[model samples]
Target: MSMIKTIKSLPMAVAAAAVLAALPMPEGTPIFGEQTAFAQRAESNKKQSTRKVQALTADFHKKLQKAQEAIDAKNYAEGMEILDDALARKANDYERAVAWQLKAQVFYEQDDVRGTISAYEKILQFADSIPEALEIGIIYNLGQLYYSEEDFDKALEYIQRWQNRVDPTLISVSNLQFIANLHYVRNEFEECLKYIYQAIEIGNSLETVEVKESWYSIALSSHWELGQYEKVRDVLEILLINWPKPRYWTQLAGIYQELGDEQTSYSLTEAAYKQGFLDDNETQLVNVAQIQLARSAPIKCAWILEKAFKENRVEKSPKNEKILGQCYMMAYEYEKALEPLSKAAAGDEDGDLWFQIGQVQMQLGHYKDALDSFASVIKAFEKDKSEKAKEKTLSATMQRGQAFTELKRFKEAREAFKTAKRMATDRRDKRMVTQWESYLKAEEAREEMLNG
Candidate 1:
């Protein structure tokens, strides 16, 4: 089975917005809410320490204010120019960090991801001088930026750096899921499972939370990749309860089959079919039919294939027709078997199909059709000198003699028995031919007596 590839990571804008929301706003800028945890901690430390906090110079502050106004007005180009000019001047570490922060905002406004990442990395260069809250936010935002750029390795690196600095209890479910997604994309299944299970456990523990479907999806794909079918089945059961998508139902049924629970597999697949989930999937429909036939429900199998054929969902290829024909024959629906059997027989080159068709014709007492079917079987093997082919030819000839006898064509019956005797190598086969010849003579004499 192909791995499910859906991911539910936050979009770049949303991730960036989250980072921007958590950090301290520039001077004279509007604060959206309370200060960040790191910001509050830094403020408390500042109060306890005698050392002075670094401040931006008046000239640098003026340029920063001008850039912020241009940005607030949606004048991205002017905002970028002013931030670039401020960064060009020789400034203190704190001033450079603030300028880069404003530049990152400008790049973000212009939807320039590379520029945004560059600006954020520039701020990180001043990590020792910048506020702890600002530095941590930049690191986390860089991870999200790299992810948006599809640089998964760099994304994971930066995200791990951010995680190390933050308290373990402060990490949210979304952060765990994001880390899990990074691991999944990198093919680190074991690590992916570790983080995903953590996220699932945390989310499930919350009274008001509904776990995201994509979390279970990641677990399902991770287990499948690791060849842990039992775990995959467990995740799929949860998905079926919460999501109940058609794909989840079919995939769960497949997982049951992989785990060697054929009975459960059949039951689940049949249930999905009853719900009309398998109607559009021809291969799966045919698989369910095969399982039904194996479980001795040939009538059910035939009904499925017959319906599929009528709806044009399944191709009426010789192989499919042969399966349908066999299903009907097993169910004792000889008359219904003839159409598909004849079509399948007509397309076969090996004569085995014709032999089966001949048997069905004999069951229906259609001696002429049976005679023709047996003749085709014999003709199909006439050129093959293999022992298996010769055996089939001999069997067809014997059946043909019976067909002729039933039609009152005693002369043809005698010729067919003569042909069979020539081909019979086994003592048992020779004995059977002898018995048939004796019956032919007795039948011929009985007919003569009746005519006289």
Candidate 2:
């Protein structure tokens, strides 16, 4: 929070006055008298003010020289104390202002934010003109303080005020970076986009590569937050065309994902990963695979999933394994589906995953395996800890019994239906179980009679 040390106040006032006068004033406005009145008054009241200030400034300069001598002599604290006293005794407003500004610098060296802010405010009140640099410096500190205190409106007020005063043409790369961060912290996404774009514009005029690349990321992210997906796409296209970084590809993939274009998302992400854009994080890769599943490109989805799974580079959590299983099943690769599906089913006490696994196995003519999976589900809910689980478990068991019957294991199917009929407490469940059991028994009797 160091104060603006070299204000160049005289030049700033002259520039501001020139800009103001150049504007079309009223038809009869006299510029010279109107502007000079305030300047004249300040001069009159302090006729010897300049001389007094100069003398005081020389004294402070001498003290500062001695303080530097002490510092060079390895007496740090004593040097600081002497400098503090010199600041306290300044003779007039202008001289006093510089003293406070200098004190702020000293305090900043010691990391004393409280002293720094206090001294900065005194300088702001007494300085001749608020230089653009000084305005930016002080307002930036005020914005930070207000933000820390949770006073967002005040924070926004000062930051925007400072931004308005800064010359766009003179905004260096570092200044633009600072401005970008301030807008981001305020969550003014639109404003962030505007200034960041301005930075890009300036960088392009100067042919500055670093700032231009930075603006691409800033523009992409801000547009993403605003749900302006098309703008993000456009910015990414330009970035790819010009700079062609890995981030451009990854961001393009993310934008396509938002646009519900999963194939493009997958292609872009794959390109990024191949080109080494996406890091070991693999977040973009995961998103692309997931979106492919959503788009029903199951073979491609499974291919991506299997690559990540086999590499052990990314942890294959059970949920992701389940997705891979579903993809494989959709791709008609049932044998590959079985391993991940089985792991997902057995890894948790989830009735739905178990049901899905059983249904897939049944479709593949693995009736015995299907029956076992569903049987485990039924046993898991036998005590009926959750009513919802109980109903699901019963339904799955009934379906498994039907699957067994299709395999001509009629005796086991009959026993399963009988057990379920006895266990069912809800009237609807009881009725369903009774009907199924009766049908099974009738079928068995027909088989026996035919044999006889």
Name model 2 segments beyond 4 Å from true: 1-61, 71-74, 84-98, 129-177, 208-212, 238-248, 260-263, 273-279, 282-286, 290-297, 314-316, 352-356, 359-367, 380-452
Candidate 1 overall lDDT versus native:
0.80
User: Which whole-number lDDT from 0 to 100 does residue 249 have in model 2?
Assistant: 83
State the RMSD for candidate 2: 10.2
Cα lDDT tens digits for candidate 2, 1-452? 23222121111211111211211223443331132222332334332223212223455556755765665465758877886787677355544554454455555555454565566666667534422244345655555544444456776787677557544444455456546655766677888887787777776677544555656777777887888999989989998998987777877877787898877877788677767565465566666667677777888888877887787655677777787888888888888998887887777766678777788778888888888879777766777778788777778878777876877789778877876776588899888887887777787788889999
The lDDT for every candidate, in the order shown, is 0.80, 0.64
* Every model's TM-score: 0.85, 0.65
Model 2 gets an lDDT of 0.64
lDDT of residue 404 for candidate 2: 67
The reply for model 1, stretches above 4 Å from the true place, is 1-53, 69-75, 348-350
Clash list (residue pairs), candidate 1: none
Task: Give lDDT tens digits, candidate 1, residues 140-194.
Answer: 7678767767899899999899877765766678778888988999999999999
